[model samples]
Target: MPEEVIFESESDRSREEIAAYLRTVADNLESGEGITLKSDGDSLSLDPPTHSTFEVKAEREGPEGGPKELSVEFELEWPEDGETESESGELEIE
Candidate 1:
């Protein structure tokens, strides 16, 4: 089964702004040196310097219902010589 990765941050900005920011981040991650993305449909696999692979799923939820939330889900596989680690960053609306 695939794992769910969720990124939750409270932002007073509009959804469009948040989505744009995320797109930028994703694009940067995809094009950054030593990082690559192999994707199909709703899934993405990432390979980084540690020789690990990560499967990612990202989406947004908001005003159409209640408070806004940016959700990202993924499962990581570490390299034979490395251990898997999880990290996150928040963007504040100003």
Candidate 2:
């Protein structure tokens, strides 16, 4: 199955900023480089970072009866310096 990636930000930054940042991150991912950014209400999440991510809630028929919802969390870890690394909270998916 193809992996889906999505990005969401807290109710702080503007939509334009979030979109720009996501675009940059996507570019970096395409180049096989790790990206690190300080939390500013902006975040990104991906299923595999190779396919695509949707902002809308996705639903599927459950095997038993009801509907099933699939949610995922993603973290970004970037190398800072020699033996030093930085980590950030999971990107908001909602």
* Best candidate (score: lDDT): 1
Model 2 stretches astray by more than 4 angstroms: 1-11, 40-94
TM-score of 1: 0.30
- Total residue pair clashes for candidate 2: 2
- lDDT string for model 1 (1-94, tens) is 6656533344477989868766765665567533333323333434454334556667897898688889876544565465556545453434
Residue-wise lDDT of candidate 2 within 3-94, one digit each (tens)?
A: 44444444556879768977987788888665664456765443233333323334454567766756433444322232322334354555
What local lDDT score does residue 70 receive in model 2, on the 0 to 100 scale?
Answer: 66
Per-candidate TM vs. native?
0.30, 0.33
Q: In candidate 2, residue 19 scores what lDDT? A: 83
Name the lDDT value of residue 55 in candidate 2: 34
Best by TM-score: 2
Error of 2 at 17 (Å): 0.6
